[model samples]
Target: MVSAELLKILVCPSCKGDLEYDVNADTLTCMGKHCPECGMPVNRDGKCADKECGKISKNFVGLRYRVEDDIPIMLIYEAEKIPLAG
Candidate 1:
């Protein structure tokens, strides 16, 4: 459980993208762009938009960080990858 102030200042360490906090899941997810066609996760440079989604566009992927005892584990290596594959 992170305070609103803390959550606002938190960003994805990997991509430097904004993070969305999930209260129920007690996690912080990165709001990075993805392939709008196939829904594969995209890189910060807008490359590697999944080999399937030939079209370069936008989707959403998340790097989820868990929170324990009200402390958020914001380490990039510890974050979980969540791809919105269509």
Candidate 2:
């Protein structure tokens, strides 16, 4: 339940990428996709969908942050790196 203003400025510390906030779910998802070298879709499971590039997506590639008590835990170490729909 972070304020819209705070959410607007928040970015992933690992990748410096955009984050999608689900208000009802109270989750923050890093909007990073694909491998820079392979150019394949990074699945919700944080793995490259391409069989050739069967690698786990980078640390910032999934739903990793959570909002608790109206505050977002933006720390990368505390981030819950779990698969979630973008």
Candidate 3:
């Protein structure tokens, strides 16, 4: 588990968005807009933040990052795509 101080300071590295920590799964999820083309979080420019993606689209999805040994694996490429309910 991450320390309260650390959790308070932690944010999504990709979009600089808020993250919700899951205690049982030991993961952090960013409920920000992400590119649907490549599933990478989008930046303020409306393009996929990841260099590999870089897709310019309005469609987006949510992403989840795993935590190992209390350290969040916040890499955009490694994040799992999740559906956002309308």
Candidate 4:
């Protein structure tokens, strides 16, 4: 579980947005809540509720979290870069 204190320190590089703790993924996430660039939800499913993705970026449309065995695969170059909503 990610501590709220740690989540308080995360930010979105693309938009200088504030990030929140994504409970389901246990990863930090930016609160674009809605993608300003694409004007869509960052998640493929278009959800803005408690359930969110923690990956730093999502430059693609159909790609999901690149986790293995419940572990996050935080690949720098492969990370998806989503346009932030903030």
Q: What do the candidate models score in CA lDDT, each in turn?
A: 0.68, 0.68, 0.80, 0.41
TM-score for each model: 0.63, 0.59, 0.76, 0.35
Candidate 2 lDDT over residue span 23-79, tens digit each: 889888785654433434566776766687678855423546888899888776577
Instruction: Give residue 2's lDDT in candidate 3 (0 to 100).
Output: 74
Alpha-carbon deviation at 60 in model 3, angstroms: 1.6
The residue-by-residue lDDT of candidate 1 on 3-75, one tens digit each, is 9988878877656678888899998887566444333456765564456555654445557789999889877
- Which scores greater on lDDT, model 1 or model 3? 3
Candidate 4, residues 5-84, lDDT tens digits: the string is 64455444433455554577655444454433332344554432223343333342221223345444333334344444
The C-alpha stretches of model 3 lying farther than 4 A from their native spots are 43-59
Which 10 consecutive residues of model 4 have the lowest summed lDDT?
Answer: 56-65
Worst 10 residues of 1 by lDDT: 33-42
> lDDT per residue, candidate 3, 1-86, as tens digits?
87788889988876778999998888889888988766666777778777976798765777899987878887876889776765
Q: How far in Å is the alpha carbon of 21 misplaced in model 2?
A: 0.3
**Residue 52 local lDDT, model 2:** 74
How many clashing pairs does model 2 include? 0
- Report the C-alpha displacement of residue 28, candidate 2, in angstroms: 0.8
Query: Model 1: what TM-score?
Result: 0.63
